[model samples]
Target: MARNTIRKDENTTRRSKKELILRLSVYLKPYKKESAIVIGLMLFVMLCSVLNPYLLEIAIDDKVANHDVMGLLEIGGVLLVLNLVAWAVSIIRWKKIYSINNNILLNIRRELYTHIQDLSFDFFDSRPVGKILARVVGDVNALKNLFNQSIQLLIPQLLNLALLSIAMLMLNVKLALVCIALLPILAIAMFCIEIFSRRRWEIYRKKRSNLNAFTHEEFSGVKVVQSFAKEKDTNDEFKHFVKNLKKSWNSAVRLNDMFWPLVELSAGIATVIVFSVGYKLVISGEIAIGTLIAFSMYAGMFWRPIMNLSSFYNTLVTNLSAADRIFDILDVKPDIKDAEDAEKMDKINGKVEFKNVGFAYEEGADVLRDVNFNVEPGERVALVGATGAGKSTIVSLLSRFYDVTSGEILVDGKDIRKVKLESFRNQMGIMLQDTFLFSTTIMENIRYGRLDATDEEVIAAAKAVDAHEFIIKLEKGYDTEVNERGSRLSLGQRQLVSFARALLANPRILILDEATSNIDTQTERLVQRGIEKLLQGRTSFVIAHRLSTIRDCDKIMVVEGGRIIESGNHDELITKRKAYYGLYSAQYEFLNEGA
Candidate 1:
């Protein structure tokens, strides 16, 4: 995998902030009634806030100027009532917004999770788990913040600006026009800043994701790092990556920082101009002192909303960048999918056929080239080959993990691609050289093979694979917890548990890829006996490193350079003294010498 390509160019077809907000609103439409209540409460809060400035104007113009004691008391009482109403409205809006934001976050998280599950394995194969986690958790959270804060303020902020502008203009048109004129310049500045910040932010996000992937991969392979004494080298590499991340981070923040102080400076200039002009109007008897005072207060209040709009504009850019990162994952089309008219196969007879099959992970370098093979129902086929000889690739194709580049793979005489993935995979059991066990109880792990299987059925499967005895010795028996990746169990034990899991699935086709390679000789013999019982009357394919495991297989195939050069039963192959014979004899002598 090339690290350079991890951060691609920004998506050319970027969605505008308004378009994103509209799409998010549609998602919230299902809860329209609650949304309506939230909007209403927010409006009430804005109305109360606007009334505060008006109250100050009235106090200066009417009560104070006229020296009416009774009028002053009545105005004070009304002000108190307005404050109380504002507090109530604020609380109601807070609760409603909080509830709506949480619900929207929950729904988005759930949808993303479900969509991830539906994606093909190829997507997971290329992307790191940590990067995926960041998109699902971190990026989604950023979007939620944007949706909750930006959206809730959107209508109220616009309305406040409009109302304040009108109130200010009614007092003095010249001053209002001055403030309005500055807006276009501010708008152009904001647009330029947003464009620069978006690109910088995208770079920062990519670097962050790359750092996450590197950290996750390193930690997961910590034992290997320690065993090879590569700690210093790894630490230095990590520091280099972090340095790149910090540079991008600082660049993004610096660009955003420049916008706000400039806006504040412009606001200051606008204020000085308003005060100078308004003071002259009052001195010349052209305007009343009350009107001049009101105009000054409204002028201050008016710029506040504009300042907030500027801040919101920056925030909107940040949110959109985060949203773009999230949508990138959701937008990726899965490389593998069943045909549109695919149907479920309830009973698979286990007969597999590959006709003129060719495949490559990358084009032109064929992993399996023009290969053809057939295994009848209940036949045991052993594939023997050196590394990179396409043995594992063949099994991967048979299981439909990757579709053939050319030709077709048929299971029970029907193309595997024409069967629903769930049904197709359910009919086959695969055990790899390295087994994976979830952090769960023993019983639950086994039951994962057949989700609806009863406890009794689980124990029966474990017993069949000779895993029941060791499981019972654990403190919790069937309920014994297998910590992360079953680290508590020995290698042989984990392999046996995996065998039992496969048995529980009761698959018609079985694939064993060096399943017993990690066990001791004694455990190997025990597992071999269990495997014999498990493989009885089932169509099985065995990829073996130790030749003894496949000596009794009905057919032995020699795969070399992506083609089967020789194939026959054990006795016939040994007599032929071909590739399979040479491999078997060499391993046979090594084992005998050790004995």
Candidate 2:
């Protein structure tokens, strides 16, 4: 497979941030009651905050200036009460916001996972597991701050700014005008910075995704890296990815950092102007000292929200790329889906046919061309070929992993594509060269073939593939817990368990592609005996590298570059002395030489 690092579809029609934000608002609808309560609490908090500075003006200009100590004490007591109430409400708001964030993110990740499961193998073929993990995990996590800080503050911040401006203006309009003088200029500057910062943040996200992909792929294949003594090469590549991420991080952070300082400096200069001018007004008695002080403080309050809004906007810009990446995966339509009116397949007898079927992973690069074959009900057929030949591709087409680029496949004379995927796939069992086992007990692993199967049924499947003995020998027997991918098990043991899994499914049509290649000669013979009995009544396809494993197969087809060059029973192919004959001879001699 090619190294497919690009996760986003370049051809996808880009959506404006407005559209994305509006779509995100839909999630809020479900939590409207909680959201409304949070908003109400924030409003009360804002009211309490803004009223204090006004009360300060009242106490100073009315009570303190008139020598009324009792009135000043009452005002101070009211201020204390308001602060206590605000603090208590603020705690509740924080708790509610956290709950909302978790629930919304849960919903998004659930939808993403469900959508991905329905997508075709073609979607996975071009993207590494690491890149997919990055979007699902890291990218989703990046939206947390957006929800907590940005969304929670959005309405509150605007309202806060409005209240502060009104209070400042009511105190003294001259100072208010001077304090807001630079806002228009700040807005223009923000617009310009955002345009450039948005692009840099996107680059930063892509670089992080690339690093994730490279790291995951190397770790997955770490065994190969060490076996081939490529650790130095791999470490060098790792360093390159790290350095690229570092550079991208610096570029994106430098631009984003400019916002906070810029907002602060502008507000600082405005405050200086307000106070300097207001000092003259107080002395001239155009405004009292208390009013001038209150107005200047309110001016400060007004810009604090502006600073917060700037911070919120910056958060949006930073995570917008993450949202785009997430939506990109969701936007991909499954390549292989049942027709709209498709229905469940009829009970299968496992009579299968490939009628001039041709397939390509890429356009005009056919992997299987004009492939034609049929397996009669209850027949056992083996496919043999060198690496890169169309042997596995043919079976993959039969299983509907990828639709044929040309021609069609029929199961029981019904088009597979016209049948619902779940209904069709349920009747077929497929075991690939690499068997993947989840981190669970061995019993649970076998029972995955049929979730409702009894312990007896699972054990029977294991006994059928001769996996029962080794399974019992484990410290935990059938309940033995396996690590991820069953790494604790030997290759041959894992293969045997995989065979048992396929057998437990009791599929009408079974395909085993290089399933027994990892087993030893003795174990293969034992497995062969059990498989022979099981193969008596089901149409099955087997692909193997060892020629001896398939000698008993009813027929053998020798596949070459996207075509079947020879087909016959084992003895008949040997007599013909063609492609199958040569392949068998070479393998036979190699086995003897090894002995």
Candidate 3:
């Protein structure tokens, strides 16, 4: 397997702050009714807060200092009732916000996953799984926090500030003027912090993603590392990734920490200025003592939401980078998509044809050039070649995992590219050298081949592949749990399960890529019987490593340097004494030496 270089530069995808918000809000459209209700509740909640200071003003002026006991009690009762209503509304509002936030997260993650599934093999070839995982997991999680703040915090805070401003100005223009003057300074400070913090966060996220990629890669291939005794080397590489993450994490945290204090300092300064002026006005009788107290209370209300807004701004700036990374993946249009006029291939007869096919993994570097071949329905064809000689590429093209750079692939005499991808792929079954099984019961793993398959049908498929005996022998039988990647099962057992899965699909065309390479000779004999029956009446392409396995192929093509150098039956090829002869002779000699 080739290790692809990680392109660090691709992580720094940037979008304008305005565009990011607008794009995210698109998810909010589906739940507009809930959003509206939440916003309305926030408005009423702002009214409740704004009314408190004015009520205090009246309570102090006309009841407390006036020594009217009943009036004071009445005011207290009103305040209590108001606070109760505000609290209740807040609880309901947040409940709704939480629901909306989770739904949006679910939708975004689903969309990302679906898009990734549709992408061509080349996309996966170019990027590591960890990089993609970061976007799907960590990045999506960050967006959830932003959504929560946008509804439950940002919108309400802005309304609170606005309503508080109006109430303050009506009560006393002088105090209100002084309080509002600090707004511009707070805004400037926030702007400056946001600019600096955004860059730090972007770097931090990239480092975090890099760390995740490295960890996933190492753990996934742990066996290889242990076999080569490269644990120390791998640990060193891990430390290198962690050190980079720590530096970026520290830098981002340091910048983020500075934000709260600046916001609090601005609020603190506003408080001092308001009180210094309000106290003198009260002493001079220009404003009543109650009015002075009310102004101070209103000033607190005003600055509190400013602090909230500042917090929201900080969150927004940091998460904006995450949003950009997510959109980068969503923006990748799949290179292979059904054409506008593509037809649905309902029932394929599986006559495969490659007409002047040419392909390349990269430009000007052809992997297969002008490759031409044809397989009539029910023909069993064997593709033989050295490593990287393009045997696998041929199967990939036939399955339309990739499109030919030049020429066409036809199924049932119609160009496959002109057929709907899903319909075309549904009729094909592919078994690779490495078979992947999900963490689930053996029954479910086999049923994955055809989701609609019945339990008996699943067991029947397993039986067809000679997997039933071992499966039934297990303590749990078909219900036995296969751990991740079917790690608990032997490699041969895993391959058998895969064969059962592919067989259950019952595809019109079958592709076997070194499928029997892992089985022991005894097991191989049993599997071969099953395979022969499975291959009957289907167009099959087999890539075989063992020369003997392909002896029964109707036609054998000797692939060399990305072209079909020769084609004949096994006996005819051995007699020709060319490339196939060389391969057969080497294998025969090896088997004889072992004997």
> Quick one: best lDDT, which candidate?
3
Q: Which 10 successive residues of model 2 have the least lDDT summed?
A: 5-14
lDDT of 2 by residue, 1-595 (tens): 2337633322223468898898777777888899889989999999999998899999999999899999999999999999999999999999999999899999989999999999988788778788888889998999888887754789889989888888887878888889989999998888888888878877887888888888888888888999999999989888988888899899999999989988998999998899899999988889988888788678878888998899889998888888888888888898889899898997799898889988888645778888888889988899999998989889898888888899999999998999998999998989888999999999999999999999999999999989999999999999999898999899999988988888888889989899888888888877986687567688999999988888888889989999988888999999999898889889878878999
Q: Name the TM-score of candidate 2.
A: 0.94
Rank all candidate structures by their lDDT, best first, as comma-separated numbers: 3, 2, 1
Poorly placed runs, candidate 3 (over 4 Å): 1-10
Give per-candidate clash totals: 0, 0, 0
Give each prediction's root-mean-square deviation over alpha carbons.
Answer: 2.5, 2.4, 1.8
Considering every candidate listed, which one attains the maximal TM-score?
Answer: 3
For model 1, the stretches where C-alpha displacement exceeds 4 angstroms are 1-26, 593-595
lDDT of each: 0.82, 0.87, 0.89
- What would the per-residue lDDT of candidate 3 be over residues 1-595, giving only the tens digit for each residue? 1334443534456899999999999999999899889999989888888888898899889888879999989989999999999999999998999999999999999999999999888789877899889999999999987898888778778778888888899889999998888788778877888888899889988888888888898899999999999999989988988888899889988988887888788878888899998988888889998888888899988888888887788889889899999998899888899999999997988798899999987544888988988899999999998988999999999989988899999999999999999999999999999889999999999999999999999999899989999999988999999989999899899999999999999999999999888888988988987898789889999999898899999999988888989899999999999999999999899999999
Each candidate structure's TM-score, on Cα atoms with residue i matched to residue i, is 0.93, 0.94, 0.97
Model 1 Cα shift for residue 382 (angstroms): 1.6
Stretches of candidate 2 off by over 4 Å are 1-15, 571-577, 593-595
| True-structure RMSD for candidate 2 | 2.4
